[model samples]
Target: MGNKKNLFTLAYAKKFLNKKGLELFKKSNQTRSSNSFKSLSYTVLSSLILIIIFFSSPIINNFKNNLITQSIEVTNNSKNKLENVLTGKAIENEQNDKLDILQIFEDIFQYEDKSTSTVRLSASTIEQLFKDTKYNLKDVRKNKL
Candidate 1:
């Protein structure tokens, strides 16, 4: 932290990191009890990491659950409305709020992807797909809504 010099430039940063790595490697060979600061730094860093991991789980899980709940509700409401409309029951009830197509689209757009699946595409393949005709997503989604 001396003078807070700009050590972040690519080459300088790499050299600084490599130097720090060698210093830590050398320092670790010394008796752990002798260099209390070294051991303390390691302990503090590890504890901080563990604390972050512990505290963040509940918050992340809650957000994920809320999104899943919303998606499920949207799916169910769309299914029920489609059934009613198809059965010739016109929804004349103005009190009942109709689903917002844009909201559904936004939800899908901002969706939390939990998929662990890996997909690989080559550059030419991606370029070909990019050149393909873009279809209206609204048309298909609107039919369900």
Candidate 2:
């Protein structure tokens, strides 16, 4: 019984992978390569078709335009909503509340008034700082390029 089983196994192996079966396996491999090439070509062709459809289609252009217009509308809506909230709250409050809200927004947004602070530099102050350097104004005035 064991010998029969072994013989069956050997016969099965020879049917599929022996020298004569090797030629058949090689032919199948060739066909598989050709099949893979065909699939690759189909993939490239489909991708190119999709790209052409995406670019040349008016429906796609309209979709893109709609997306852009919708985004702009959304931004405008948000700005209007913010302004409405600020104005609506300010109208309900006293005059002090309006100043407080403005101050709060200025603090949050860091909108400092630059005109209130002035920096004045004297010529002697600048000359004293550059006394050790050749870039002093007196030296600079005498310098010729």
Candidate 3:
């Protein structure tokens, strides 16, 4: 009776192991396939992102630098033009007055921001004014170059 019980236990153990092994192999195959697909997809996406940035980075940087330079130049030109306008006015007034450009802007524009560069007169209209000023500055200097 003892030998018969041991033989039955061995048969049950063998059947269970075979079934579990097959299930484990199937699960591993599915996981491996999915992971491989995901890895390939990720690699392609990363490569494309890198390529786009590599191609576009220099152009974007150059464009940014050009705009900054142009803006500074425009600000300088505005300063000169504003000064000339005030001085010319003072000369025409013929009151022998020494005009101070900064004071004139301060007295006339009278905004509380207390900044020193060319200013947009009104907050709501600032963008269009800035664009026009920049464009005018560009046009003024275009012939000088």
Candidate 4:
């Protein structure tokens, strides 16, 4: 009786598996093949892009070098023409104009007098000053003040 029951169970299991399990396995295999094909295509695309960039790099570099050389030549020619056009008096006047501009900036930014004193406060003094106020260092830092 046990042998018959076991055989019946085995037969039912085999039938159930044959109906659903085979389809599941076939679908999984198809998905795996599709995933592999996608990966292969991505790899080929990336390799082609890399190959294109590699082949074009020299051309890009040569173009950049030519632009740089042309700019340098242009600047050199401009400098030569400027030097030829400017006499000694004009060069001296240009230098004087540069000095006057520097002087103006210095005059705008310079302190009025060296007699003005800067008071140095210690950390304890700073803390004491803030202790009376509503704002503490932490609050000030948090508020970005």
Candidate 5:
């Protein structure tokens, strides 16, 4: 019985293959091979890129460190020049003026919350609260939030 079934299946497959022609089969095989080749090439390209970045990371870090050190040295030189031209008392007064300005800004923007009340609502109540508003779930979903 199994042999008969296998032979029937094979005969049907052969008939179908003949109807489709060898050209179609060849084209599909070529397409599959090209797709695999493309995937392999992409994998190799990405690996090469990662390897290059890995090998060059120390050089990049050294360049960044050089830039940071140069900036620190420049700032130190500028600070020394300023100190040379200014008296101690003048520098102390300048720092005091900066602190006073910062304090004024802090006072203007200071916030204190003293609320001690708590309110809780059920799911239905929450739904009702948003039923007539644009903040409903439907609107939120439409807005992709």
Candidate 6:
């Protein structure tokens, strides 16, 4: 091992040129000689196809049209749902017409509900409402997960 000189430098490379060339060729052949040609061709063909699709005006226009149509569809669906809720059609049960904690406090403290139509809420009723809302919020979070 001591007698063998480190011949990796350019000046000494010529002495082991044949051995180094054989090793490099073996590595190259193992990696990308014949078996990888088909894969390389497929990659180039796919890249060209993608580039063409991206550059083609007709394809670009079609993609834009599809996006616009899909967005319009989503907007129309949400609009219809909002319209249904506004018309009271979305409310299947009359029990769903109750207010939440924030709404209850706002209505109570702010004196927003001046009408004699609804009954005034007591302290026990408020406590019960808080408990019910807490349970409902927990149930909703659990369902989401």
Measured against the true structure, the TM-scores of the candidates, in listed sequence, are 0.27, 0.25, 0.30, 0.30, 0.31, 0.23
Please give the lDDT score for candidate 1: 0.72
Q: Is candidate 3 or candidate 4 better by lDDT?
A: 4
lDDT of 6 by residue, 48-138 (tens): 9998977897877888888766653322366667788988885333355665889878878778547668788998886788697775556
lDDT of 3 by residue, 75-137 (tens): 235666678797784322325378889998888777766577876577547557657666555
Better of 2 and 3 by TM-score: 3
Which residue pairs show collisions in model 1? none
lDDT of 1 by residue, 1-145 (tens): 8655744576766677797774323445677677898889999999999999999999999998887666543223666678889998876443647889999888887775545587889987766764674424465377653
Model 2, runs deviating above 4 Å: 1-52, 55-58, 66-110, 113-118, 122-145
Which ranking of candidates, highest lDDT first? 4, 1, 3, 5, 6, 2
Instruction: Quote model 6's TM-score.
Output: 0.23
Candidate 2 yields a Cα-based lDDT of 0.69
With a 3 Å backbone cut-off (N, CA, C), the pairs that clash in candidate 2 are none
Q: Which regions in candidate 1 have their CA more than 4 angstroms from the true location?
A: 1-34, 68-145
Query: Model 2 compared with the native: what TM-score?
Result: 0.25
1-145 per-residue lDDT for model 5 (tens digits): 8787556565577678788873323445356788999999999999999999999999999998887666533224557558766755343232333457777777766733434486889999878878856477877779874
Worst 10 residues of 5 by lDDT: 89-98
Winner by lDDT between candidate 6 and candidate 3: 3
| Every candidate's lDDT | 0.72, 0.69, 0.71, 0.72, 0.71, 0.69
* lDDT score, candidate 4: 0.72
| Residue 94 Cα positional deviation in candidate 2, in Å, after optimal superposition | 29
What are the C-alpha RMSDs, in order, of all predicted structures?
A: 25.1, 17.5, 23.4, 14.1, 18.7, 18.1
- In model 6, state the lDDT of residue 54: 72
Model 3 TM-score, 2 decimals: 0.30
User: What is the model-wide C-alpha lDDT for candidate 5?
Assistant: 0.71
Model 2: lowest-lDDT 10 consecutive positions: 89-98
What is candidate 4's lDDT per residue for 1-145, written digit by digit as tens? 8787556565576678888755323345356788999999999999999999999999999998887666533223556557867743343232333457778778866856444678889999888888877678789899896
